[model samples]
Target: MASLWSKISATLPLNEEQFPLQFSNKVESSVVERLRQSRQQLYSNTTSTSRMLNAQIILDISWEKLNTGTWRDVDKEWRRVYSYGCLFKAAALCRENPSEDELLQAVRTCDMGLLMGAAIMDNILQDIVRILQCEVRKSVKEEDEGEHMQVKRRKTASPHVPSIKDGLAVPRIKCPSLESFNTNYLLPLKPVILEGIIDHWPALNTHPWSIDYLRSVAGCRTVPVEVGSRYTDEDWSQTLLTVNEFIDRYILNKSQISPDGVNDVGYLAQHQLFDQIPELKEDIRIPDYCSLGEGDEDDITVNAWFGPTGTVSPLHQDPQQNFLAQVVGSKYIRLYSPEDTDKLYPHQSQLLHNTSQVEVENPDTEHFPEFIKAPYLECVLQPGDVLFIPVKHWHYVRSLEVSFSVSFWWS
Candidate 1:
């Protein structure tokens, strides 16, 4: 326990010089004073309950400010305040004889702060959360190693049944030289399946992303999930849920399939999950191909897509170039050239301009007669395949089975 506390304490900022309590000049004096007082009370010997309550008050002030303004316009000081409040709350929860639930709460609080807080601040909470996660994993492993190992072995040996689709297939090639890829595919604005590229990823074999492994690493962390069918539906909406709850309610409940198809599909789509959880990030490498564009590696955006078999991404065009890598199961993908955009019947509303009104699988010909004329390239992207999609290329995707894919977007 002492060792654990030492590690936690080491992650905290050393002094006010490292992490000042002062607010910007525009902030009211009373609010700044309250923040200072809260910090002071945390420093002094006080009951953990009192510390947590005081931190909650600070968090409430930050939350109110966040709600009042557009995210981009929100004051940076409030983000810092929110982060500090979470740090204080986590510290209070970690001290003395904290229960397992309290420790887990501390980790979750820190993750929330990291997700929403200013990146410029001294983010000690990230390191603290990492430490707490490791501790929790250790404790959990000791208690359930035998059970989890059996599950992992069973899943690791399970055969992957490929989904073969017949259509005008995307051209395929082995790993190409950067020059060849840029000249033949990237510059020509063509979509192609580059095989044998991601086989070396740890996610492929070393730390195979089995359901049990993912649950062990990130099941407790909260993530936003898209519920209902695809986003084009009137009932489609997003809700925050723990990864474990999402897996159980959506992924594991195969019996809940409706007559038309799977109902209530919950998709964790286009989320920068690697930024929130570092453990999962270490399992995969950023493709070197992302550097072929104008931006460097840091400018690339990585997103995780995990959902059940029937999950669908309505036809849409993204602004940046994309490299969608299949990691777990197969996906049936169809791509239409930007030249055929008019035929696809894109939504006119500015909010949904990038999305198409036509459902590729069940298109209403009377409403969208031109959709039938659009030429397309299609493929079943198996695990270890990387499909390069050029900028503003309209594409539609449907998972053939339970799938997890990572996409890197860059310009």
Candidate 2:
């Protein structure tokens, strides 16, 4: 854990060791009690709806950001805001499939994101569902055998790689419900955009945010997010760096100004690098406080979200799977699968986390000629678009317009 934290801190410059967090016993106790009560109800009565309700409640309160900085005003105000919106504990209650002990372990060990824990639960539930399905199939086969009193074999078509349309085309209908979405569309590794889903948010209005604003939003405030909780080390000082300075700055310190608007928009530092974007130095509302953050590397790192014009992360991947989501703005994504190891010509040197050494924008075919023929996937991700980059997929993203999105991963 310490190595992970240090690596994260070294990769993205931030005060990792002293990450700030304060959890209230009142909040924690209430949440635990709620879960316990719901668990009891679930075990006692199959007809009870309490399990579902408890799951919903957990989803709603899981992502509340801890109060950053020492200001009581900021703390109280933000808590109220989060409380009002309700954190959708996406991980906690996706489904109830894990055994009681396993589920309890997940709850205790999950990071602030609760990604791994939730996934375990969901997977367990999925397993049960699969088991039931298999039982039904077996019964049907038995019935057929009894009726015919003879054995028979039938030919079946071989499955092929699926098309995005085959995966996500919604049937002509009233609207989409999660229950209706085919499991195939549940992207395992990709960026997703939930355009129409914004209506589900109770506190937020769905007006799209600009690319520049979204990337620079982090510079407006210097709030260090609570590490291992809701945010990582870089996520803590989210507003301090730009698309360009983010990775480079961590290589070493500089006399340069930090990303612009560091003094106000939730940032604690303001130095040379920040002078680039004049708007941050001038007056502007902190409409949004931070930029989109990277997800956990253990589950699905090696991921990115595109921002229009000004947002781009260094090409990189971790030792796990990844998914990208684009809620706003369009991003042009280029991909290379694990088999293209030779074409990518990964670096012979150390100090970088990327597997593809070739320039993503302009490949040197002279040195590495095979890149042209590498099997790749390309897409313009718009609102509601999600691009999955399986583990070891080399990708470069360029935002075509103002974009907002989220990335998902597990360790």
Worst lDDT 10-window in candidate 1 = 153-162
In model 1, pairs of residues that clash are none
Q: Which candidate number has the best lDDT?
A: 1
Off by over 4 Å in 2: 1-219, 223-315
Query: How do the predictions measure up, each by TM-score?
Result: 0.92, 0.36
lDDT of 1 by residue, 78-132 (tens): 8887887888788878876677888778877887788777653456777788888
Model 1 TM: 0.92
Q: Tens-digit lDDT track for model 2 on 179-217? A: 433233233343233334433322123324332233233
Per-residue lDDT value at 133 in model 1:
80
Count of steric clashes across candidates, in order: 0, 50
True-structure lDDT of candidate 2: 0.37
